[model samples]
Target: MAASNSIAENIAGSPNHKMLHGTLQAAGLVERLGGDGEYTVFAPTDAAFVQIPPVTREGWMLPAQKQVLHAILNHHVVPGRIDSAELERLVDAGDGAAILKTLDGRDLWIRRSGASYILTSGSGNKAVITEADLAQKNGVVHIVDAVLIPAT
Candidate 1:
């Protein structure tokens, strides 16, 4: 909640983002992501992760699947401090949608859905930003309603 904290600190402190923190930790990205770097994250909530099959999700956390997990998480992050206003401006500039390059170099489409901001992933899965503009020391976080699939 405070701007003094880093993105990882913010996620770790949030009740809705515990699952994301765990995933980051599992992927060996906790230290890297938590370090001094700007990142705009489309963070999925616990409920969103719950939608994935338990076995499949559990397997992703395995040590052997660290690269896969890292890639998946990277798909949800952009290397900057893009907040809600900036995202909206980008959408407006693009006339309806904006293409955001994820940390993994995948394209993440953001479009306006009335008052909500919808994100479409490369796998065609869509997610809505349920909560936005969570500012931190390194960047901002936007809590999404679904886990936007990564490019295969």
Candidate 2:
């Protein structure tokens, strides 16, 4: 809500705050992602979490699956602060689609769907950016409708 807040802080106040925060903590990525940076995060809402099977979500939260959870969360983050405008420019530059390199070393495709942006993951699953450009101290947050899962 406030510009002084970090990405993590913003998430803590968001509607999906609980699930997002829990996932970050479980993956041990809270500090890294919460730290200073020009990063972009496609934050999924609690409704999005429903898309994931209960067993899968439960498994990912286990200590033994830390790496898996880390990778999954990292897949939602881009290295630079890519606001909606920048994302639009990149999409136009790439001729209607841009390939964004995520922090997890995966490529997420960005494209325009009408007036909004759509993220197509490595697995061909799509997530719409429902809310764009929530600014934070560390970077920006885009509320997405689906949780992005990278291709295996």
Among all candidates shown, the one with the greatest lDDT: 1
**What does candidate 1's lDDT look like per residue over 1-152, in tens digits?**
67898888878888888889999989877786689889999999999999889998999989999988998899899999999999999999999899999998999999998999999999999999999998888889899989888878
How high is each candidate's TM-score?
0.96, 0.96
- Model 2: how large is the Cα RMSD against the reference? 1.0
How far in Å is the alpha carbon of 19 misplaced in model 2? 0.5
Judged by whole-model lDDT over C-alpha atoms, candidate 2 comes out at 0.88
Report the number of backbone clashes for model 2.
Answer: 0
How big is the positional error of residue 124 in model 2, measured in Å on the Cα after superposition? Answer: 1.4
Residue 144 in candidate 2, Cα distance off native in Å: 0.1
Poorly placed runs, candidate 2 (over 4 Å): none
Tens digits of per-residue lDDT for model 2, 67-148: 8888889999999888888998899999999999999789999999789898999888999999999888989889999989
Candidate 1 off by > 4 Å: none
